[model samples]
Target: MAMTQAVQPVIRPATQPTTPARHVTVRGRASFWLFGAAACVALLVLLPLAFTLRQALGFGAANAAELVFRPIVGELALNTLMIVAAATVTSAIVGAAAAWFVERTHLPGRKIWAVLAAAPLAVPPFITSYAWVSFSESLQDFNGALLVVTTAYYPLIYLPVAAALRGMDPALEETARSLGLGPWTRFFRVVLPQLKPALLGGMLLVALGTLSEFGAFALLRFRTFTTEIYAEYRLSFDGSGASMLASILMLLCLVCLALEFRVRGLSRYDRMDRGARRAPARYHLGWGKWPVLASFAGLTLVTLGMPLGMIVYWLLQHGDAAITPVEVSLPLVLDATLSSVGLGLAGAALTTVLALPLGLLLARHPGRIATLLERIVYLAQGLPGIVIALAIVSLAIQALRPLYQSAALLVVAYAILFLPLALVSVRAALLQVEPRLEDAARSLGLNRWQTLWRVVLPLAGPGLGCAAALVFISVMTELTATLLLAPIGTQTLAMQVWADTAALAFAAAAPYAAILVGFSLISTWLLMSLFGKTAVLGATS
Candidate 1:
């Protein structure tokens, strides 16, 4: 009953599935690779728990109650939560408003504003902490910490919200307006609701930023859990106090994970499909221009101007005394840089490798397990580097004495603390790749392994590279974790800078701090360039 073949059907061999057993054999090999990747990821995630179980479980009911129910603990909890909430709300409002202005409103010179908004990300919170510490010792309080962190971390919200606004459909706004809604009302009701997910996402990021903040809290004399944990570790040496504190901090992070899952429940970020984008009409600032300009300039002066000026002023005042990068021996500089780079690269590579399997698993076929894995990453991500480092110290000394203070432990901490960056980038990349391409490869007689290698790997290579670069940058700049777990002889640049500054050798620390900032700026530039170049180019056109 089939249609008759025309012109003798250009006869072909009937061997499409001739090797059915061969396909099965190929699948077995492919599955082997899949399992290998999965095993690696599992090991990365679970290895710390294996060693740290004793420390985590060591908190008896008494210790748990003290940590959870003590007045001091309650005060710290309230303070930290206040900071998180305040920072989250302010960052979301500022970042989203800035994003909306640049991406939607007829704000002039948006490109400049966009760059300005993102500039804060380049300034390390610790350096900014140092700046504020030098700016005013007495300004070191909860309010000061909140202000500095909000100013520095708000960019997290800005970048994401900007993208979302630019990608949004202005037709919705037009619909509300046509229905007799005034501009402000339409914005608050229609536009704001549409931006809720993006704003929520930005708030989550800001909340996490505020949660893990250590340097700022330390400088401000704010006894957030991070600074408190560091105090316990340094003051008590090898004690259960630090561990108990870290476990509590971990629970705080879990709460964030729970909120994100609950609030964003079943809400896909990919709500706006293709063809949903419409350029919003620009609003002329008119007589409000001067005020807006002045506001931007003032914020810029306070946030950017004050910090840089203080650091420079102090450096120049010290002259030949404090700035010692030039005075230090070449080998010391070389050694410090090498150690930092080596440690960072090792961490980045390991994290990137693990992120891939975890990312692939989540992207290709997500389930409860994959979701749990992702939540674990996010929870760990919110932990301060100091807490994680202390936990690592406790675990290594007790359960894995042989590995204590080894480079391996340092790398392990880095992987744990910064895995979220690599995971985010890898998962994002994998999701962007269409699944149909793999099926098409199968139709073309390629087995899963062949298809993954030929199609998937190549497509994901760039993103993985970027992820590694990001992790490397983050690890290189990280201070507390490296200080804790680095081998006794290790001298990373960050450690060197901290040591110099701790000793009041400002000149000595300058070069390392400057170099650290330079390297971070380079990587951040690359990251933004990779993501924002198209937007830039489109604007140009």
Candidate 2:
């Protein structure tokens, strides 16, 4: 009886997990995962970078001299800058004010506006650009790209900035407003300054996105480093030109990183404390509501409605050009869907898990190394999928030849390209965790790991999961890298879409396109669930 009781008590302790270490597990990552992820990232970034520099240098200073001396570089540079500038400026104006209006104002349908602003994000920028190119005579060139991208990307600003504004204590704005400050003055003086970092951070995402964009630029015939690089690679088969263009892109990416830092400054913008949430006061949108509605309506019509309507219209018009399920092959579509979903989920989890370390470091250790690593991530974000794809190709062949041209290699590419997204979200969430709570956990006989798992993680865990889901959805839609890096015999929906479209079989491409959009919408719905109910918002123009 004594022995039985002792064994039973021990079993209970094991089951109950009396300590944090006993309860939490840090295992599950295989050696292949750790070494593979690290190796893949190194190979994906370094090899292409080195090879690209080699090719760029092979221009023997004469070609580069021509590049500098000629107007080609200047024209491309000006165009690039113009698009980025327009996208950034438009996104800032629309996103910031909309976030402010929704979060602070007593505007009827604030919830509705919040949903509409974010809805555009779900409609891929390229898809929007595609609609503009096909339908509107005026929507082309630099302005069209800006309009398309801004509509799609502005949500990046709205979501975070609105969240920030919602958590902001109304006391600051109220205090400012009470001091004889008019509406415009108080907003400019108090709110704008306060939201600067958030605004800039969102704008940085837009800028990098514009820099790395390929599909929209290709569709619109707008020349950019990414589009040029791809054209050189696939169309011309000129690796030299591709590398040269990629080098320019890298330079642009570095500039974007510098700008992001300048905009974000040194402040940590995430404030996810569990304390009582204070809501910002609204600026009554009485007379100003018309301008708000007009601006908002114009954007919603062009950005949201027109693109979706175009997609639907194309489907209807081409409906007679019906692609039988047998013709398109549901099995093929299923395979692509499964591949996309599985890899997207796996990559999202891996990237999110990997990003936790960097995020924690950024939150706690803001030293040069941490800053440098963070900068590297942001710089990587500006890299086109094709560049990352080409880099991985070189690295895979050289480093891990056995793993080369495998699903594992493709997943690694996805992880590297999308890791930064997970990092940003994790960092954003980490910024919200207070050190005091962690210190309190330590006082309760917990070590750093214990404190993180028991306290910090429990609080930040939701954000991490949300971040992972977001990554998964994005990778599922990713076309460029998947096109180059997906091993032989691997067929993804993105590749199928590209192939069908390239073959000029719009009817054949319809199923794949529909499937992609369906998946995108579903994934988007999942993501919006994190914030709240967000539906497609707009009126057709």
Candidate 3:
């Protein structure tokens, strides 16, 4: 969902000659070093996929088939597929409509509405699940899971589509209007076709997200592959069963990725000439204004209001004034908050640092090797955190025993899980740093390392900060990997929320949930301030 900046055509004076290549040997050597570094990072990122494949293969084919073909597997598959399909469709419709109203129509306070639409990303899906379940036990089923995930993930589609709407050229729509086409016809025929890439990309993200989601479904008691895999691992330590399930989930995600990629095939919709383009005229709501406002009001109420209202309700219930009051400990809450902040900072720094080499390579030295390495990094996006945690646990126990159950090991898992997030920001940041600046630095007798340190890094400082902050927010809210891999006796806010919520102690969970939500909101605001609305897309997806 990261909006790509258009490439400005480089115009040179007619008298200026084409620049000669200088320091070809130095560049060649630098490229080789960068390639080696990036390859190592890619291999580390590929470990989970490799491990899953190995475990599945080690389970004999007949036995694996039997395990996968059982009635329970079929049931889980159906539930997972149903939820993924429903959520993807629901999110698309809701997201697209929200984007249309916010970006294409004359909605009052459109800017505020845009921010509010993406705000759900700040609330972890599990917290949303906790809120709904605490509100009523009857919601512990398919419908509950659908509602929670739709609210949580619609922004995955909305952000990208809205960004697309903002970037699109209005010339085609104007021509269609001139030809007497109705608004609906123009939208479907002209606008929809142009938005295909962003829309499909967003839908792909929603499907993959729903398919791999763990905590939310677990809390909701919705039996999906992720939940089943977690259960198999935790209850029976059934590595083969869990690996087989994970493999199936990964395959589904891959299919979505491939489908979106194939459908989007080399499409370029950028303007061809250096012509001035004006913003598209907003559609007047007219008599529909009141209804449209009501719709937006209702949306914000459900998506933002409900979970927040529930959290506050639970917080207030933590005393003798309420029935079944639970005593909330301020010390425990503060400890967990501090722990979460510490771990988030550590994980953010480590992940961003690990991602730097690959991002640099992709931005400055793109080729077959760089592209392949990038694709390998992105393959992690398809893997759920549970699967990665499983792989890391197994690898650490079997090979890296000393690091097993260590904070360092957990941080490594965070790096692998969220590397793409950091990479996207890093690459985008580096891309904005003109190569001409580096060339000039070199011409001034600065070495490659010195040029990057003194020139490039400073220029990319804010983006790098954004990258780290994005990862920090994710680490703070991340439940799956932290649950499986955090060091003994360590309790973060996410763990506390999950623990109390799982025990049906919603009041006890409120403090942690509130702090977590607060951090997310603040961090989200910082991201928007730094990179605008499109940056929020990278924060989650």
Candidate 4:
């Protein structure tokens, strides 16, 4: 044993080879371009905030404080907050209930009812207000405003909630039932909790929309911040006062978003079961079916049918001469239609293009920078359209005088206001594409750009299309921005309708309204179609 141990080898610790510390900076052309473009968009979106802050500060703090503390400011804030709270709650409840009836019950004509319910979204709030005001002078106050907005926005909640309900796993409900839970009990305790995200998202949209709404509140003679902002710009020419109000409105928007996130917290609703699951059983309304059907029918009548019916009635009463003799101003109508279409297409294309970089960045490599940029863009979206329009107006007059009152400037404003819509849609589409497919493409000798171009784009085409259609419809129906920034000679259908209605020219307004509704319906159909059968039916859950 001594002889065998005589030559034992000494062991040393293994060391990783110390390569020279080279400064390796790996960069891609695509990544560089994406980040740069995203940065530009974020700046573009933040310009309004920057200008508003500058203007608010330009007026001495004491002066700004005085402006904000006025009775008008408090009144505007109260009106705006009340409307936002009411509209969001009413929209969520009506939308979710209607969605439940359509998706989870054995109701007759569910398909038709679902389509009718969503059709109200095609009727712009202003147009609905116009219709209601024409039909009855009584619908011009708080109740009226609440009714119109609820009808107009409920579809936002309905679409997402319906989609969520459809996608939800049924086993949870089955398990609850097995534990002796009744249908309504299981729904409230089990299903509603799962719907929190969708409901919250839809409610957020509705709240922001009500905050930014202009024409409805204006026509209803409600003194919300939006109407006052318009008055300050148009009548008093008080830019500082308007800016002060906008700043307040912006703060309110931020608060709403913060509250939403706080209430939502960190809840997760993913299914734990790995295998395929069965569809949840639908509820049979049994003897309650007729009442449910009547409810939907009445809702459809008020939300969709009323506006449409009134449009027809006005057209017949005032449009008889025009309808019989074809004396309607064809050229003006034609020009306005063309203008609307061109602006819509331009806004949609530009917004979608701008959305791509942010969408891709957020989807692929989310970080603080990307998240902050996205949030900045959304802040602009949540601000009233008039605020963005006024900001652009002030900037154009100050620094870009030559561009003032140009159609291009108006398009930029549209892009600024609606870019969030396209961003959300495109990001959603990007999320659906599996990264493995991109990896597979790379393994086949394709570069990243080529992989994205050929594989990711095709997979996300439907969503992109949906984004375009939605933006187009939104631009078509837009009013406040177009009024303030459209070129001297430019006329959109929305503008025409607004002007004619303001003058009590119901017949003249009818054609523009009809055409506007037509385009909206077409675009809404496109949006719903791309989303899938239940896309607008509320099955996205």
Top-lDDT candidate index: 3
Candidate 1 pairs with clashing backbones: 106-282, 322-507, 323-507, 324-507, 324-508
What TM value does model 1 have? 0.86
Q: How many backbone clashes does candidate 2 have?
A: 3
267-316: candidate 4 lDDT, tens digit per residue: 88886764685676888899999999889989989988888887887777
Our model 4 lands, by Cα RMSD against the true structure, at: 5.5
Candidate 1 per-residue lDDT, tens place, 145-166, comes to: 8788988888888887787777
lDDT for each residue of candidate 3 in 1-541, tens digit (9 for 90 to 100) = 2233222223344445544434777788888888888999999999878998898889898989898899999999899889989999999999999999999999999999998999999999999998898888899889999999999999999999998998888888999999999999999999998888888888988998998798899899999999988888887664677888888888888888888889889978777783685898899999998998898899899888999999999888745533345567778888899989998999999988888888889888888989999999998887788888888887887889999989999989999999999999899888778888899999999999999899988877778888998999999999998988888889999998888888787888888899999999999878767675335433432
Ranking, lDDT, top scorer first: 3, 4, 1, 2
Between which residue pairs do clashes occur in model 3? Answer: none
Q: After best superposition, candidate 3 residue 223: deviation in angstroms?
A: 0.7
Minimal lDDT window, size 10, model 2 = 532-541
Any runs in candidate 2 off by more than 4 Å, and if so which? 1-51, 54-59, 66-71, 134-138, 235-238, 263-278, 319-332, 356-374, 397-404, 425-464, 499-507, 528-541
* Steric overlap count per candidate: 5, 3, 0, 7
Give the whole-model CA lDDT for all candidates, comma-separated: 0.74, 0.70, 0.87, 0.85
Off by over 4 Å in 3: 1-22, 319-327, 532-541
Sort every candidate by TM-score, greatest first.
3, 4, 1, 2
Q: Which ten residues in a row have the lowest lDDT in candidate 4?
A: 18-27
Model 2 residue 506 CA deviation in Å: 4.1
- Judged by TM-score, which candidate is best? 3
Q: TM-scores of the models, in the given order?
A: 0.86, 0.76, 0.92, 0.89
